[model samples]
Target: MTGSDAAGRLDDDDFPAYTMGRAAELIGTTPAFLRALGEARLIEPLRSVGGHRRYSRYQLRIAARARDLVDEGMAIEAACKIVILQDQLAEAQRINEEMRGTASQESDLPPG
Candidate 1:
């Protein structure tokens, strides 16, 4: 896939794209900061067969949000917490959708 500039929608082809240093350069952050986020579980790094940190476009977006929160004067820990909560909320929403879909499917079925 062709490269996408900032604000462009990333595709699966964007996966396994950025190495740690390159990702740091693209996000305007240090590799240490990215590692810290990984330690905090804010962003899960994709590990290669040799265990190197490979970042995806989606992970870069998370890093961008963490950077934004830090620049807004929030502490890194607080920023990490916000990111975690947002992830949990997204998971909850996904589960709710699945449950609702199951209910709908059941309603559409004939009585047993």
Candidate 2:
């Protein structure tokens, strides 16, 4: 990729820019914790060409939430499930809002 492209990717939350170690350190967690999250199907870090795991900012946010739940006495598996459900709920809510907006706009139009 070009230098400009690489620079822009740094701002992309979904870009796997952080290495495993850096990701763990940034979140104040351990590499093993990240591995456990991976095993639990929580966050799937991308694999680099050399086989190292790379995490995105978005994944780190999810990891941080999972870690918070764990700190609150939730099991890792349960935390993962909760995070998944939470994500689904957020998406559903967003879609519902969009549909509501569209329906309101349609209602404003005169019937054919």
Candidate 3:
């Protein structure tokens, strides 16, 4: 790939750039922890050509949040569920804001 192409990928939060080990190290966790998160269906890592798990920055953030919940004495299963619900709620709120903005804009238009 061209240098520009490689540089562009640096800005991609979803790009599977970090290996499993690196991801775990960056998040101060273990490989098994990431595997457990996957098992719990919390975050699904992409597979490299050699069939190894590759995580993105976004996935790492989610994993970090799960790790925090687990550290707070929450069960792994419950932590995963809470993270999933949190994601869903955040998405719903974003959509709601967008819809409200659109409706407000429509209301400001002249009656036709």
TM-score of each: 0.69, 0.96, 0.95
**lDDT, each prediction:** 0.87, 0.97, 0.98
Residue-level lDDT of model 1, residues 1-112, one tens digit each, is 4456532534574576789999999999999999989888888888888899999988998898898898899988899999878988999999999999999999999998
Better of 1 and 2 by TM-score: 2
List the candidate numbers ranked by TM-score, top first.
2, 3, 1
Show model 3 residue runs off by greater than 4 Å. none
Better of 1 and 3 by lDDT: 3
Clashing pairs in 3: none
Candidate 2 yields a Cα-based lDDT of 0.97
Task: Put the candidates in lDDT order, highest first.
Answer: 3, 2, 1
Error in Å for residue 105 of model 1 = 3.4
